[model samples]
Every structure is written in C-alpha cells, then in structure tokens.
Target: MRTLVVVRHSKAEQSGTPDFERHLAERGHGDAADAGRWLATQGIGPDAALVSSSVRTVETWTDIAEAAGWDLEADFDRGLYSAGPETALDLVRLTPPETTTLVVVGHNPTMASLAQMLDDGEGDPEVAGRMNEDGFPTSAVAVFAFDGEWADLDMGTATLVAFHVGRG
Candidate 1:
C-alpha cells in the first residue's frame, strides 16, 4: 500500500510587513520538532518530500525533516507555496509510483481540505478527530493509505489512516 503524508507547514512568525516572507517563530520550531517525532512513531516517514517555497513552510520542513531523519532531498516548488488543494493533489500525482511514501509540506485549507476531501475507509477514529479538532494547525501531519497508484488517488478514495496534528 502507498502512503501519503500531508503536512501543514509549522507556525511562522507574524511580522509587521505585509509580505509573504515571514519565517517560523520559536514556538513553531518546537511544534515542528514534536510533530516530526510524532510522524516517525507513526511510521509515516517519507521517501521524498515536496515542500513549499514559503519561508515559513520551508523552515517548518527543515525541523521536521531533521527530526524524522528522512534523509531525503526536498523539492521546493513555488506552485505549492500558495496552491489550492487541487493543485496539491496534482503535484502528488506527479510522484513516481516506485516511491512508496511521500511528504507534502504546504499551507492550510489546501492540506486540511485535501484530507477531508479524501474518501474514508477503516480510518483511526482518533486520527480523524485530530484532523478536524484543531483546523489543521502548523506542522500538522495527515496520514493516508491507498491501495492503488497515486495517479488514481482521489477524494474519498482513500482512508484517513492517522493524523498527527499540533496542539496549538
């Protein structure tokens, strides 16, 4: 079975400037590390990661990537920094089928919506609860299981296997 790990970027600093260059805050660092450790325990480590180019998202992935010891080279995609759920889905499809697992570090609404959009099947009750309980916080990770190829993955086609979301 192939797995998809949809991770929302960790919390970022809110600067006075109106630009999209805000970096992660101190709390964001801790949260991401905790979240990464949590992913390893859940066996959600990815062979590769498709991360956003956003300063916050990039920084978020750095901590989690290190904590998980994934030892993978990440693809920083500008499209993902501000893409919608559909866009994210398309990106996942681009992954090679040989890749057993993948991690996508991106923004909210898209990540959360993607999880909610996927079809359910024998999912962990607690996992689903966490995905919705906190609105997909920064550094949150949503685990999904699929029996087929990524190209065939669709909303409601997979189950919400597990969710390692943030507390804040």
Candidate 2:
C-alpha cells in the first residue's frame, strides 16, 4: 500500500558549460514550482526524498519543495547524478521500510524508461490510462503503488496511479 513518486527534474537550460553544472532557466523554475503545486493537489508529501547531486536536479527539487511547502529534508546522492534506472531502483530497494512514501528527483530517459519498465498492472484500465496520458515533461511526476514492501520492489511490480506532466 506504499507509494513511490518519481519526479523527473524540471526542464533545464542548455549552456556551453558542462552537463552536471547547468542551471535551471527562469522558465524551468516556474515549471518546477508548478509541478510541486500539482503534486500537493494529488496529496504527494513524500516521507523521504532521494535526489541527484547535479546542480539542475538540486535546483529543481528546491523549487518543488518550496511549492509543495512540505519542508521535507532530502538526501542528495552523487551516485544518482548519472545513474541508470537499475541503479536508481537499487537505491529505492534499500530505502528503510519505515518510509511509507518516497520521491526520487533525478534525470531521464531513465525516468521514463523506469516507469514503463516497472509497471505491473497489465490489464488494469487505470494503469493503462495513466500510461497513455503524456510524456514525463519538465517537473513531471509519476505515482505508482507497489504490491510488496519497498525493500522487495522489482521490475514490472508497480501499478501506475497517476501521471502528471505539469505545465507552467
């Protein structure tokens, strides 16, 4: 009955600078904030937040936290900066079972792929409906429910609850 929310970091600005250091554009800040607000409407206050250490990811989470007003404390991990979906899954699996809800704010194609990869509800209409909604845009949040404890979550074991692609 626990929830896992995966938030693909907000749209970021491209610069001549290296990828890890790029900052969020002005529009991205607002987009990230919009996502946070939307998540609030959906009742998404994560008990724990696992975030990437990249600058853009950090900035996006900051704006999201401000908008959500959850004042949540997050654990920033450098491994998440360039980690793949499997790596991310490992982090989630290791989360303390006491955490009822969790959020992972990071990058994608891994995010999108992970959603599809971990979807468990094959014939359920709502799961398919949510999957059909839209791409995981900047600040997009995907919510899913796992059949087992977080410690035992596996590929294709999650059922999509809601897919939010926020617009600013």
Candidate 3:
C-alpha cells in the first residue's frame, strides 16, 4: 500500500512581511514539532516530500523534519506556491513509484479542498465530520492510503486512514 500525507502550512503571522516571506509564528513551530513527534509515534515517515517554496511552508517543514529526525531532502516547488487542489493532486500523481510514503506541505484552502475532495467519506466518520465543520486548520495532517502506484492515483481512489490537527 501507498501512503500520502498532506499538511497545511502552520500558523503564520501577518506583519509587514509579504505573503511569500511570512515566517511561522511561535505557535506554528510548536504545533509543527508536535505533529512530527505524533507522526513518529504512529510510525509514519515520508520517503519524500513535496513542499511549497514559501517561507512559512519551508519553516514548517524544517521543524517537522527536525522533530521526526528525517534526513530526506524536500522537493520545493514553485508551482505549489498558491496552486489550487487540482494542481496539488497533479503534483502528488507525479511522485515517483518507489516512494511508498509521500508528503505534501502547502497552503489552504487548496490542501483542505484536496483532502475533502479526495476523501470518499469511508474512513473515519468523526474525522470527516470534524473536517466538514472546521475545514483543514493550520498544521493539520490528512493521511490517505491506496493500493496502487502514484501515477494511477485518482480522485476518491485513496481511503482516508488518519487525520490530525496540531495545536500550540
């Protein structure tokens, strides 16, 4: 089976910084690190990660990487900067076949939309209900499982196996 993890960038403070340069807030760092630790406990580790090049996204990944002790390098893509759900799915579909676990770190509502759209509503009713109500909050991780290669991933093909939202 293949696993896909989609993570929305952690909380970012809006100041004089531009959208692309905005760094993660203190809460974001804590939340992201907690998420990493949680993933580690669940024995979930990504073989590869596709991350947005934006500052907040990069910072969030760095925190997660440190806490998870993952040495893999991330493929930071410019196309993921502000892309929508379709673009996010396309990027996931293009992942190499050898990577059994792939993680994507980017912004929302694209991340949330992709999670909600790809979910067949057959995994966890509680998670799905919470997602429907609150949407994908920052630092939320949505995990999907499938029985095929990355190239064949289709809408609603993967089953949502787990979902988590980290908080400071």
Candidate 4:
C-alpha cells in the first residue's frame, strides 16, 4: 500500500510583497510544527515530499520536517505554486515508485480539491463529511491510502483515511 499526505501551506503574511515571496506569519510556523507533530504521532513518515516553490510553502515544509524529526528533502516545484487539482495530481504521479509514503504541500483550493477528488468514499465517512463541510484551511493535512503505485493513482482511486487541520 502507498500512503499520500496532502497539505495546505500554513497562514502567510498579507503584505505588499509578491505572492510567491510572501513568508509565513508567526502563527503559521507554530501551526505547521503542530501539523508535523501530529503526523509523527500517527506514524506517517513521508519518504518523499513535493512542495510549491513559493516561499511560504517551502517554509511550511521546513517547519513540518523539522518538527516531525524527518531528514527528508522536498522537491520544490514551481508548477505547483498555481497548479489546480489535476495539475497537482500530475505532479504527484511523478513520484518515484519506490516511495511508499509521500507528501505534497501546496496551496488551496488545489490541496483541498485534490484530497476530495482522490477519495473513493470507502474510508471514514465522518472524516470525509467534516472535510467537505469545513473546507481546507491553513495547515490542513489529508491522509490517503492507495493500493497501487504512484503513477497509477487517479481520481477516486484512494481512500481518505484521515483529515486534520493543524493549529497551535
């Protein structure tokens, strides 16, 4: 089985700075760390990560990796910065086949849409309901379980095993 974790970048400053360069806000750091800690508790250690090239997203992954005590490195993809659900999925599909656990950190509604689109409606009904109702927020993480290789993953091919909104 393969595990996929989708994450929306943490809160970022709303300054005049370019969107790509916008840094994470104070709360974002703590919240991302909390997310990492939570993933650790769940024993979700990712072997690969694909993150947006945006500054905020990179910082978000950095904090998450540090807090989770993971020495993993992430692939910073510029395409992910503005990728929609399908595009994001294409990026994830590029993941190496040997990677059993992978994480993708990007912006929403891509992250949120990707999570919802991938759900096969065969896992936790309550969690899926909550995710649909609450919407994906900053520091949100969606965990999925797939029975095939990364390249073969497609819409409705995975089960939404868990949903979490990290807050600190």
Q: What is the TM-score of each candidate against the true structure?
A: 0.93, 0.92, 0.96, 0.98
Candidate 3, superposed: residue stretches over 4 Å from native: none
C-alpha lDDT of residue 25 in model 1: 88
lDDT of 3: 0.89
lDDT of each: 0.83, 0.84, 0.89, 0.95
Tens digits of lDDT, candidate 2, 1-168: 788988888878888988999899888898888888988898888899999989999998999889988888899999988889999999989899889889899998778777777888654676466555666667878888876788789898988887777567
TM-score of 2: 0.92
Q: Please report the candidate that would top lDDT against the real structure.
A: 4
- Rank list by TM-score: 4, 3, 1, 2
Alpha carbon lDDT of residue 151, candidate 4?
Answer: 94
Pairs clashing within candidate 3: none
Candidate 4 collision pairs: none
Steric clash count of candidate 1 = 3
lDDT of 1 by residue, 61-118 (tens): 8889788777878999989977899889999989998988988888878888887888
Instruction: Estimate candidate 4's alpha-carbon lDDT, on a 0 to 1 scale.
Output: 0.95
Q: Of 2 and 3, which scores higher on TM-score?
A: 3
Across 23-73, the per-residue lDDT of candidate 3 in tens digits comes to 999999999998888778778889999999999999999998889888889
